[model samples]
Target: MQQGSGSLVELLLSADNFYELVSTIQYLDVIQSRNSEAVSELVSLTDELALTQASLNAQMDEAEAEKQRADEARDEAEEARDQLEAKIAAQAAAEAAARKAAIEAAQRAAELAAQSEQQTPTFTTESGNDATVEVPDLPDPDIVVPDSDKDAFVSEWSARIDAYLAGSPLAGQGTTFAEAAWEYGCDPRLSPAISTVESSTGRVCFLPHNAWGWGSSSWSSWEEAIWAHVAGLAAGYGGQLTYAGAQKYCPPNADAWYASVLANMLSI
Candidate 1:
């Protein structure tokens, strides 16, 4: 009883009380360790969240960059399309203008041709003699020819022959040809047409103005040649074309010469 009555501070200092105090301290330390582990876990979770946010930001940046590239590509494509359309429009406009110009030119040309047809220009004979002949209007096909118009007819024939041989050596011999034809009762076109066939209208022949290719013959002048040939045709072949006459004239190539001469005569 005296021991139990001892001081309470001494009782607390005893081994059993001390063991209980140590146990309580250990439990408090365990609780603090668990709290520290929880704090570390929270820190790790926060770090992971931060990493995930960073990754999401990077993905968003990449997506935005891709969108910018796509937009640029679309803009470029639109620009190209617009350019192509503009070029096509320009080409179409050019073709339309060309067509319009051609139509206008054709209309103008037709108008000019009509005007020219309405106006009959005078043709003056440039043969040896200068004669101003009035170009008659379209003649009446039913009009009968009077004997008095013979000289006028011959003059017209002369003009036609002269025009036909405008650039030839026998150009100015139309009047001579007509006179010779009248004198010999020969076709006016015969001698000259023969000359055209044989010598290209006296351009090439066997010598000095020998246009008719008449038998190794040469003449002093075109007039001498013309008279001689016309007289020969009148005397030799009756101033007419026949196959027999052609054979007599050019024995070697009669058929060819005859056909060619007939064709030339038709042209005249």
Candidate 2:
């Protein structure tokens, strides 16, 4: 009976061991299932990370391209600005040079006039006799003469003179002639009319600036010549247009010269 009881106990212990083994096997199965799920999750996370990294790389490339374009635009703008500034500088330099040249020309004209004034001039009469004349102190050509009728005379005769002298070498010399005539108390039309007869309004002259065919005189400028001629008329011809004056002016062809000069004067 005791042996039988020991056999039964052994069987019970074996049964318990079998039950424990079965439980351990169930736990191991659960652990394996959990491990499989974790590995799958890791793979999914790796794929997502790769996709995000690619997107970031694409954005960075686009940003770099944009920056390069901006830089190129800025460089082009600067180049254009530099070119514009160069053009402006060149224009300013040219204007300054032109102004300087004009000033120099005016100075040269003044100097020549002063030199001519220092020398005594000779006038040839109708009889071909040379007469020495003292030059009077003349007013500055740059300054306007203060006479009541000066403006009216200049306004009327200058326009007429300019109209007649249009397309000629002496085109712009109307104001000079008018002013000189008013200053020296000479007939405004006399010298210009004589010029039309003698030198075709200064187109053909025997000497420089001697449009009136006056005494082989050469002048540096038209202004000086106009002033001197008007002054000479005032001193010699009594500053009037007369038959006797015309006879004295051109003894060789007095009648024709007088008629031509009168016709021109009337036209002006």
Best by TM-score: 2
Local accuracy of candidate 1 as per-residue lDDT tens digits, 83-184:
999999987676445434433433444456568885422111111111112111221111112234558757976786787778998998888877676667
Q: Pairing residues by index, what is the TM-score of model 2?
A: 0.45
Per-residue CA lDDT of model 2 for 97-138, tens digit only, reads 543443344344446656888543333433243322222121
Tell me how far candidate 2 lies from the true structure as C-alpha RMSD in angstroms. Answer: 20.9
Give the worst 10-residue stretch by lDDT in candidate 2.
Answer: 134-143
Count of backbone collisions within predicted model 1: 0
Score every model by TM-score: 0.44, 0.45
Candidate 2 local lDDT, residue 151:
87
